[model samples]
Target chain A: MTTEPRLVEVRKNVLKQNDIIARALRDRFREAGVLAVSFVSSPGSGKTAFLEKTLTLLHSRYRVAALVGDLATENDAARLGRSQVPVKQILTGTVCHLDAAMVQNALDGWDLTQLDFLFIENVGNLVCPSSYDLGEDLRFVLLSVTEGEDKPLKYPTIFNSADVAVITKSDLAAAVEFDEAAVLRNIQAVRPGMEVLKISAKTGEGLAEYLEYLERRCSSSRAGAAASN
Target chain B: MHELSIAMSIVEMAQEESERCGQAQVLAVHLRLGQLSGVVKEALLSSYEMACEATPLEGSQLLIEEVPVEVFCPKCDGPRALGSIQWFCCPECGTPTPEVLHGKELEVVALEIEE
Candidate 1:
């Protein structure tokens, strides 16, 4: 009799492994009382500019660190490092998006407990970044007014996945004839009742509100974790 | 392209499954892809060959089954297929529905391998 090998049916998501690691990282961040925030946006949307300004503003009050991802180049990390906050650059090589594996690798040798906030600046792409969860407590999606107000309608998936939407480069709004009402309406249409913040890294307008929002979210999550524990 | 990375994951998973079953080679991988999954099928197919090389899934074929977006119509109280991602209106009653029943799926459902 010919022996037949038994077929084992295994229906598991390839991303499940990454999810597990991400969940663990989230728990670790919670325990360490670190507010981990991530950013996703298209190329040239002023992510690095906003991040540099944010780091400079928050550096005095809280310990902040950042990890920047790109297909190639440490330029972003180098620029953000000028703010004098610890920064790491993740080179994804041929990969178009930043996965949890890359984040874990980048965080190696760093003490999570030392920092009050960790910002992960994802690779500048609106599409692929939404699929990977990097265990951040908050996700900020940036859209510059110069890009157009209908960006939310064009990239619903990214907007749907993000917790907060930030309209960057608001200083150029008047010059670019940016329609604020239309952008807000489009954002609400895609993600109903989502929080939207308008800011200009150059002028520092509305940066205070954004920081307060971050502080509120961080504290709320901390309270929730404490209650659960 | 992101397709190459996705293809690599598929190949790795297929290889692991083949080893578990003591299979000599993987013949095909069955995938269910939704129209709104944000994955370009043509790009994925092109990258699959390159990603699968030097792996157990080498020469394996990807069998993609397209899944249409199904939404629940509030006006009609019935399920309807979405023609496009932009338009979420019901074809029967022309009422807009935001509740999605099925779509945005990218999964490998089954594997055909030779023992």
Candidate 2:
């Protein structure tokens, strides 16, 4: 009888390295007292616009920086840089999602202690970004009114993975006949009692609450770190 | 898609594993893909073939075992395998179960190396 192939047991999680790096980054963020947040959504969901407004608004109060990821271009970084915050772009180059290594590398010359908040704008895709955690304290998933209301139900994994849900393009909700209640219900069904916020970046509506939320998280995180020390 | 990158990583792992075993030829790679892993098996299979070319894992098969979604049902006080993909509720008591017990795995369990 012919010899059989040798069976070797190699139990390894493919994303273990990414997870480890992300953990380290999270610890670093904690120690440095910087609140890091990330945004994930499908393309055309207005993440860039929302971030630009946030940067412009928050820069007056706190030291903020941004790292944006994309497959090819630096266009998003360019747009956000108009807010006058330190912005950098990580070109993924054929990669659909941003890993922790990329985030770490992008932060290379910057001192985390110098900033109160660091924003990572992930490449606009709901599916892949959910799997890769870039060491963010807050992960926001955006859904636009123009998109269907069932997006949360259809993509439950991303919604479940996210800390909060953002309804973008709220100014056009009535114009597009978007079903606000149904979308809220769908989000709640996928992730029960998940916080949902409606905002129009163009009109600056609901941004005060968003900024307040960020301020609360940053202050609380800093306070927690101080207490631990 | 990201499957291509994932497949490339799998091929890299297989090649490294082969080298560790004194450059043994890899016959196949066994993977545990969960339903909640967010990876499409068919796309990964095709990407694996493309990724294996010119590598030590060339011509090796990527055998995938799909893991269905399972949840720890608080009401049932046990784990229940989802009957369908649509809803993620307890099958026994019909309660929403958000605590996932399984189906998020993406691991390389074993490999079939040439003897």
Candidate 3:
């Protein structure tokens, strides 16, 4: 049977599956009034250290849980478990990034209403993670001082996708001769008016301010204090 | 990178679309890939062949149209194509145009199928 090929109009998002699940998760988080924050950064950018510091510090004041995604090991999960808060490891195997379905599955059995903060630590990759959204209220992209000021320019897509840029490993800024001004300029060049913060988990410097900022932003969001009002 | 997974998603979508059209065989998929979509066009094109293998969409071609980064220029009060992804500014007026109007598309706009 000879047949001609026909052109079919089918406009669809390639990531529609992930987007659908992410939307559901976002709605769930909104209804439960939980601020879900996701971290995306290149490898060795201090994502784990910063998160460990954050979870430990916020444990006493608020309910916190973490879902850490890695390629194969549960090492990050084990380290985060030291904070004595609920922590889970999602082994992505060969997957370079964590998608929304993985997050939705990992969050099973955990009551969102019981938690004030749920942090999703994505796999340590710059390019891939930016394509997937895990239903987070805030996406903080980390840029370490050791990585140089051109990091933002090199990975502008990820920077544009993130809500805030955190300058990590600031304690070594003096030794590395890190140019804060240039880094800030590159960040602004890629993403104009993006909020930026600097902190060192090692010295606990800027941790207090970061925590305050996190809480303040959460409350101001529609899911944060709308129920109370 | 993640382009393989993205290619797989496109193949999956094509299969479903073909099935909807009376078990038609998909010949090609037309995709609108923006420069700022965080996806590399070359990588995706290379991965598409592998993704289509062992599937109903085998031998299907992925025709991609690259969309340039466009930002809403607040000063100009109109859309402007950005010169570079690193710089989010209006090309003519050089205004800082943070509002992105386009160039983030990862959509499959059309498909060629044999019924």
Candidate 1 chain A minimal-lDDT segment of 10 residues = A1-10
lDDT of 1 by residue, B1-115 (tens): 5777787887888888888776656788888777666677898898889998887687889988888878888888989997766556677886766677777677888887666
RMSD of 1: 3.2
Winning model by TM-score = 3
In model 3, the clashing pairs are none
- lDDT per residue as tens, model 3, A1-229: 8688889999999999999999999989888888999999999999999999999999999999999999999999999999999999999999999999999999999999999899999999999998888999999999999998999999999999999999999999999999999999999999999999999999987888899989987777744457654
Preferred candidate (lDDT higher): 1 or 3: 3
lDDT of 1 by residue, A16-122 (tens): 76788889889989988899999999999999999999899999999999999998898998899899999999998877788888888899999998988999999
**Which residue segments of model 1 deviate by more than 4 Å?**
A1-8, B68-84, B87-102
How far is A78's C-alpha from truth in model 1 (Å)?
2.2
* CA deviation > 4 Å runs, candidate 2: B83-86
Give the per-residue Cα lDDT of candidate 3 at A219. 78
Query: How many residue pairs clash in model 1?
Result: 0
Superposed on the true interface residues, model 2 gives a C-alpha RMSD in angstroms of 1.7
TM-score of 3: 0.97
Which pairs of residues collide in candidate 1? none
Ranking by DockQ: 3, 2, 1
TM-score of predicted structure 2: 0.94
